[model samples]
Structure formats: C-alpha cells, structure tokens
Target: MQAQILNLMRELQRALGLTYPFISHDLAVVYYISSRVAVMYLGRICELAETAALVERPRHPYARLLLDTIPDLEMSGRDRAPVAGEVPSPIDPPPVCAFHPRCPHADARCRSERPELRPDGGAEVACHAVEEGRLP
Candidate 1:
C-alpha cells in the first residue's frame, strides 16, 4: 500500500511538475525515494547531500551511522554497528555541535563550537571534520 502511494505520488510529481518532501526514519526508504537527503541530530540538520553521494560516502559520523544501519541482504552475515550513544536532551541542548556527545569525530572544537551548514562538494554539511578537510 505504501509502495502504491509512493508510485502515485511519483506520477503526480511528474505530471504536475511539483515536488514532495517524503519524510521517513528508514534510511533505505529515504535512499529509495529521495533525490536529496538531510540528516538531523537533536533537531539540527547535520548533513544534506545527494542520496547517491551520501550513501556512497557519508561526510558526517551520524549520517554514516544511519547509512550503515540500513539492512543489506548482501551483507546479511555482517554484524551491525550499534547507534553510538544516548541522545542529548532537546530541552536547552548543549551550546556546541548537537551531535558532539555521540560523534566519534568530535573534538574540543566540536564540544565548544557549533558548526554551520556549508557547501562541500555537492552537499551542505555541518561538521568541523568536513570543514577542516578531515572528511569528504
């Protein structure tokens, strides 16, 4: 039923020359339906990229974890990496990068400074690592 609705939406999009924000928590579903993808951590948009590029090479640690979490039939025997850590409270969250608590790439700068979304390749990413050329 969902697939049918998505197909109809796609048809409508083509016929009407319009776009729809198809939101979902399932990374696989997002990859299947979205041309662009945005990853949010603690209500902040951490990364935005073309679905293909993001899936192939995620620029942010949180986005990488999300893509890695997608179940793959080809890698059925491989163990899944756990989602990093507990999410910080949304109420008056940290003053720094929101994902710093769980980000493996986070450093002192990330713990103290908030990153802004900036263009990198074909994406807009909010990570000190991406800005510092540590990740592409």
Candidate 2:
C-alpha cells in the first residue's frame, strides 16, 4: 500500500511538474521522494541540500545522526548509537543551538549563540562546529 502511494505521488509529480515541501522523519522515504531535503531541529532548519548530496555527506551533526539511524544492510555488525538525550520542550526550547545538549562536539559557544545556516561543502549547515572546521 505504501509503495503504491509513493509510486502514485512520484508519477503525479513527474506528470504535473509539481514541487512538494515533503516532511518526514523517515529518511529512506524522504530520499526517494524529495529532490532536496531539509533537516530541522526545534522548528529551525539545521541543514539543507540536494537529497543525494545530503544523504551521502551530511554536514550537520544532527543530520548525520538522523541518517545514521537508518539500518544499513552491509554494516550488519556496526554499532549504531541512538540519538541521546530527551528532546527539549518545544514551547520553551533551549537558547542557541537546540541540538547542543545532545551534540557530541558542542562547546560553550554552541550553548550561547545560535548558528545561522551557512555553506559547508555542498550543503548548508547550521552548526558552529562545522563552521569552525571542528568536525571532520
């Protein structure tokens, strides 16, 4: 049923030359349906790029973590670390980078100043660490 629906949507998109602001936590499905992708955290876009580029080389820590959640058939024995820490309250979210609490590379600046989306490689990423080349 899901496959049929996705196929129908794809056909309609091709036939009508339509564009969609597709939103989903299911990365695999998003990759299949979207030409571009946006990764958001606390209602803010953390990363944005062409779907294939973003999936192949995510610049933001959150984006990387999200993609890592997908099960890989070839990496059967690899350890998968779940996104840690509870999501902060959306009503009164933390200041600065919303993902700082859970981000492994976060520093004092991340806790104090919000980062704006900036070009990082082929994608736009909103991360202080990425901006400073702290992340490889």
Candidate 3:
C-alpha cells in the first residue's frame, strides 16, 4: 500500500509539474520522492544536498549517523557502532550544535559556538567539525 501511494504521488508530481516539501524520517522514501534533502537536528537544518550526493557522501556528523541507521543489504555483516550520548530536548536544545553530545568528532568549538550552514563540496552543512576540516 505504501509503495502504491508513493507511485501515485510520483505520477501526480509528473502530471501536474508540482513540487512537494517531502519531509519524512524514512530515508528510502525521501530518496525516492525528493530531489534534494535537508537533514535536521533539533529543528535546525544540519545539512542540505542533492539526495544522491548526500547518500553517497554525507558531510555532517549527524547526517552520517542518520544514513548509517539505514540497513545496507550488501554489507550485512559490517559492524556499526551507534553514535554516543542522547538527543537533547528540542524545547531546551543545547547552546551550540544540537548533535555535539553524540558527535564523535565534536570539540570545544562545537560545544560553544553554533555552526551556520556553509557550502562544503556538494552539500551545505552546519557543523564545526566540517568547517574545520576535522571530518572527512
């Protein structure tokens, strides 16, 4: 039923030349329905990019973690370590980057200064680690 609905939406999109702000937690569904993707953490856009590019090479730490949650059938045996810490409350989100608590690459700057969206390769990412070239 989900597949049928997605297919129908696609058909309508093409027939009517409509653009939809397709927001979904299902990465596969988002990839199928969206040309661009904006990854959010605590109500802030952490990264935005072409769907294919973001999937292929995620720039932000949170973006990478989100993509890692997707099951990769081809690499079923690979061991994946969960990101550390917990998501801060949205009502009282952390001062700096929302993902700092869980980010493996987070540093002092990430804890103190909020990052702004800046172009990095194919994506615009809001991450101190990405800005400092600390993350690959």
Candidate 4:
C-alpha cells in the first residue's frame, strides 16, 4: 500500500514537473523516492548528494552510520552495529564537532575544531577526518 502510494506520488510529480521533499529516517524509502539526499547532524547538513551516490559512497561518518543502520537480508546471521549514542541537545550543542564524542576516528583536532561543509567527490561533507583523508 505504501509502495503504491509512493509510486502514485512520483507519477504525479513527474507529470506536473513538481519537486517534493520527502524526509524520513527510512533509508530504503529515501533511496527509492529521492534523486538527491541531505544528511543532517546536530542541526547541520553534514552530507548532501544524489541518492545513489550518497547511498553507495557516503562521505560523512554520520551519513555512513545512518546507511549502515539499514538492515540487509544478506547479513541476517551477523550482528549489525546499531547507531550508537544519543542525539546531542540542539538547544545547547557541542562547541567542536558534535559527533566527536561518538566518532571512532575523532582526534584532538576533531574535538577542538569544527569542520565546514565542503565539496568532496560528488557530495558535500562536513568532517575533518574526511578532509584529512583519515576516512574514505
């Protein structure tokens, strides 16, 4: 039923040459409906790219983590690492990288400096680790 509705919506959008911004935590749905995607973290657009590009080659750690949370039928027997840690308070956010406390690649620089959204490959990503080639 949901798939049917989504297909109908897409058809209508195409017929009318309309753009609809569909926001959801459901990665599969986002991948199905969107031409482009923007990944946000701590009220910032951490990564943005075409859906295929974003799904296949996410540059930001947070975006990658979100993709990893999608359940895979092939990995049925293996344990999936769940998205770790709570979302930081937007009202009183961290000074440096908001993801520093949870990020595995966080260094002194990440803890002290904030990263800007910069063009990386086909997407825009905000991560000092990515900018420094520490993560691919």
Candidate 5:
C-alpha cells in the first residue's frame, strides 16, 4: 500500500507543475507533498502561506489551533490549548467569521457579521480579531 502511494505521488510530481493544488485535510500528507499550505475552516480559507511559515506562525485562530494539535518532538515540549466546540455546519455558517462561535478571541462584532479575507503580513485572515488587530 505504501509503495503504491509513493509511486503515485512520484508520478503526480512528474506530471503536475512544481506548485500544484493538493487538497486534503491531512496535514502530514500536505506537509510532505506541498511547499505552500492553505488552512480552511467551515469551507472558507482562514489562512494561506508557506508550509513552514504557516505551521510555525499560524495567523488565524483556527490555523493556530490546528497547528498546535500537530505532535512533534520540538512542539511536544510546549503546551497546547484545546480547540473549543464542534465545527459548525458549512451549510449554515455564521454571518461573519464562521469560526467566531468557537474562537476564544471573538468579540461582540464577531457574532453580528462575518469578516473578510484581508491581507495580513504574508497571509489572508478572516477573523474580526485579526481584522481589528486584536489577535496577537
């Protein structure tokens, strides 16, 4: 099974461009096969950046939580905060920032509206906290 998967990956690499869109929720696979990564939540892209950069310094809250869950020797020494609540249904996402419901940094404005994917530093984030410069 592993050999077949590897063979397929090699074939794909040869056939596809250097930068191809490999969509999957498996971070390990993504990290192994792609140079850049885009983290999405509730059908919306929460963050996009270089794989290492995004994993090391996640900009969006969801991205941060997702990266925090990745177990690594270096990261194992650090404490991880739990991601609160279940993911909301994509068919009925919140008005503003679909992640606001479970976001620890969410505020009043978050529930009332959805945030846009605005350029921040090197990636785009769709959180009111990030839009308002409230997220650290």
Candidate 6:
C-alpha cells in the first residue's frame, strides 16, 4: 500500500507539478516526506519547527514526550517514560494552556492563563513556564 501510494504521488507530482498534502499521526511517515513539522495538542499548535530541530531538541513538553517515545540507539539502555493521563477533549479544552493539566512542569501561571506561541531558540512553543524561564 505504501509503495502504491508513493508511486501514485510521484506520478501525480510529475503530471501536475504539484505536491499532495499527507496527513497522519505517524511521525516516521511525516519525517520521511515533510520539510517542516507542526506539533499540536488538544487542537492547538504547541510547536512548529524544522523536522530535524524539533526531533533533536523539542521545546514543548508535549513534543518532548512524543519524541521520547521513539526508539533510538541513544536511548537503548534507558526506559522511555510513557506520556501520562488521557488527552482532554478538544471540544472543551482548558482555559489556560491546554497541556497544563498533563504537563509535569506546569506552574501556577500555566493553570490561570493561556500561553502564546513564542520563539524558543529555533522552535516555537506555547508554554508559560518556557516563556518565564521557569522550565529547567
């Protein structure tokens, strides 16, 4: 199926000189075909950065959690901690940062007010703790 899809996309790209949008939760597939990446949580974009940068140095807590789940030689001997708690409903996200409820680094301000997407090094993150330099 993957082979067929790739062949079809190549054919379409050659015929029309246009690229097709591929959407999936599979990080591997996204990394393979995309030049940029947008990380989201609870219907909100938490981070947007170059694929390599985001994977190597994730700024958002949720993005870090997602990257940590990937199997890698660097983490061969270590146990990858699973992301905790259930995802909140997107239909009614929290008033503040939507990820605050599950974010281990969340502080008082994170619970009270929403954070804006701010540039952090090369990535953009919507985290109060990150903005205030509270995150270690």
Q: How close is each model in CA RMSD to the real structure?
A: 2.2, 1.6, 1.4, 2.3, 2.3, 2.5
Backbone-clash count (model 2) = 0
Residue 74 lDDT in candidate 5: 62
Using TM-score as the measure, name the better of candidate 1 and candidate 4: 1
lDDT per residue for candidate 6 within 1-136, as digits (tens), equals 9868866776777799886566778898878766678898887889989888987788888888888877786656755555666677889888788887678887888889888899989888888877888765
**Candidate 2 lDDT over residue span 73-127, tens digit each:** 7876855556777788999988799998788898999989999999987888999
- Local accuracy of candidate 5 as per-residue lDDT tens digits, 74-124: 644776777786677888887677887688998788878877788888877
**35-61 in candidate 1: lDDT tens per residue?**
888898878899999899999888887
- Score residue 3 of candidate 4 by CA lDDT: 98
Q: Weakest 10 consecutive residues, lDDT, candidate 6?
A: 73-82
For model 1, the stretches where C-alpha displacement exceeds 4 angstroms are 76-82
Backbone clashes, each candidate: 0, 0, 0, 0, 3, 0
- Alpha-carbon shift of residue 57 in model 3 (angstroms): 0.5
lDDT of each: 0.83, 0.88, 0.89, 0.84, 0.79, 0.81
lDDT of 6 at 18: 81
Best by the TM-score measure: 3
Reference-based lDDT, residue 80, model 5: 70
TM-scores, all models, native as reference:
0.88, 0.92, 0.93, 0.87, 0.83, 0.82
Q: What is the Å distance of residue 1 in model 3 from its true position?
A: 1.9
Better candidate number, 5 or 6, judged by lDDT: 6
Model 5 clashes, total count? 3
